[model samples]
Target: MLMVTLLSIACCCGCPAYFGKPMWEQYPATASLPAQVADLSLRTDARSENTIRELRTDVQNAHLLADDTFAGVYATRQGKTATVFGTTGFHLTPESDAEDELTRLTSKYDLGEQQVVETDVRGEHQRCAVGRSDGVDVVVCTWADHGSLASGVFTRLSLADSATLLGTLRKHIVSRD
Candidate 1:
């Protein structure tokens, strides 16, 4: 299944996420692109070399501008595998952009019977969905705003957990560029 393949591709690094601060605690929100994304610069191993290469290629081939910033992070945390790719650019229609991103994932992976998860993050428009691929549960989420758009594929995490993690990661990700 496409989702499984992506999960494997994303399970490249095994570093833990920084959960010291409360995931729900709201910090100041900025409407600018990110200078760096957490978990994206982890060290890699032989098992992850091909995966990293493929993910980088895919992100480069994505519909981002020549000067826009991009990153595809493969990380495993608390036994869950997440492969996320995000790009920074200007887009006013976050709602439509979020939907279009979900549509892209729906077509990219065989996610049957997708269920939408409502995610409300300040200063960002986000859409999340839960589905199954190859009998393995997968949660796909995307968030977009005036400055950035990003998507991720997660496995073995509950819908709520998935949404929360992405929301938490956004705090460390989006910053003035």
Candidate 2:
């Protein structure tokens, strides 16, 4: 019994060391892009009552901005009357200053009531803010991890819902390899 217990403990502790860093840590592409569109969890359901009507991926445009960037937009509909748009992007900039970017966005959009929050995203830090732009409610979430930056802008959803959705979407941008 003693030998068996010791062996189990050794194996448990050795596994992680043998595996090295996670895939996200080792590759910028994996860490910066979502594995799939469905991973964003932006779909209609009985509870959400929101059906995705259109999905667009702009890989070429994203590549124009940066060699390692992924961008997408989703348009969702509610019944026949309401439509909402959400956009997400992962940009890899070796010298990105997350704070400066946040400041620029806040200034351009006139964001209000900004709050710094902890995020599951593998980043140095995350910031979230809510505001109104052109008579529409908007939520912006930004985070920087190493040289990669991730951000999401959500509209037509409640502030609380926007935050929740942004968080869920950010969590899905993981290393698939």
Candidate 3:
């Protein structure tokens, strides 16, 4: 019995402690699932220029930018990268900050690190967080839905790209003003 207990403990603490397919498998891509917010457009705002510039630089520097029609940004830094979704208006409402919300959601999943990096996406504000499993990092970005607007938009990047982009984002990106 003692041996079994010790073995169980060791096993639990072993690398990749839990047995399961990679996160990509669990959260299958919904590529074919029509765009949920394809028709939404951001409310126009002057502050959006700064937001877009920051997001563009970050995505470009990290090299994770994808050519999507939605006019969002994606980038990788220090082996980490993330995707951002913004409407034409470029504003993320107060309710759309999912960083805080994700911290709570991840708690139930045994994922680690609920630290969220809050920033403005284009003119749309956004929240980001990093989660780790089996020593791999998972980064998620969500755009908060403003009043009368949708709740928010979310996207994620693989651990490798996430780490790289996160590294670059932290070193090169600033959210002042």
Candidate 4:
């Protein structure tokens, strides 16, 4: 049932219509997080209403993916032999508790201090952090300027698609910034 719901959600917006049809298969290797040190970002407070308004308009320029599962829209960038993933926040009711848990776990992991920075998106403030586990690189960022919402995207650079995504994200951020 959960799979059905997820699939249904994945088949909407700009996602490939074929994603919901037959022959739907995910690459096994890409199905899970890579063997790397996982890093998480810090918790953020809500943004001002003006900031939210600005972010809403600015985010439209982001490089949005058609089949993104985390956020209906996401922006990608290239990283050091890896990829950087960016997306709109997940603010489901349950996600509130989840964010708190993530914050605690992130502190325990000593993933470095969460650095608050202004995102390329207007008015959005991002708390960015990076960590690694095994051989894979992990980055966790939360954009909380969009009200009671947070956007986060996890990325692995080992996959070819990830590499491509990283490059795109890098290009967009660098040029836009």
How well does each candidate superpose onto the true structure, as a TM-score?
A: 0.64, 0.51, 0.27, 0.29
lDDT at position 102, candidate 4? 35
Candidate 2 wrong stretches, greater than 4 Å: 1-27, 31-67, 79-96, 120-124, 174-177
Candidates 1 and 2: which is better by lDDT? 1
Task: Evaluate model 3: give its TM-score.
Answer: 0.27
Best by lDDT: 1
For residues 1-177, what per-residue lDDT tens digits would candidate 1 score against the true structure?
A: 999877766564321222312222222223332333343333256655665577556656776452354444455544566666666666656678777877777866665544454655444677778776567788888877656677777788777777777776666666644
Q: Which of the two, 1 or 4, has more lDDT?
A: 1
Q: Which prediction has the highest TM-score against the true structure?
A: 1
lDDT of 4 at 147: 20
Per-residue lDDT of model 2, residues 1-177, tens digit only: 999999898898877655434323624444343434432423344433422222113323322443344444444443211222222234334124455455656864578766766654443455667765667667766655443455566776655565566555555653433
lDDT value, residue 144 of candidate 1:
72
Residue 157, candidate 4: alpha-carbon lDDT: 38
Candidate 2 residue pairs that clash: none
- List clashing residue pairs in candidate 1: none
* lDDT measured at residue 142 in model 1 versus the true structure, 0 to 100: 82
lDDT of 2: 0.48
Q: Arrange candidates by TM-score, descending.
A: 1, 2, 4, 3
How good is model 4 by TM-score? 0.29
Tens digits of lDDT, candidate 4, 93-162: 3223234423643753345555554435433334546655444455555433222223333455323333
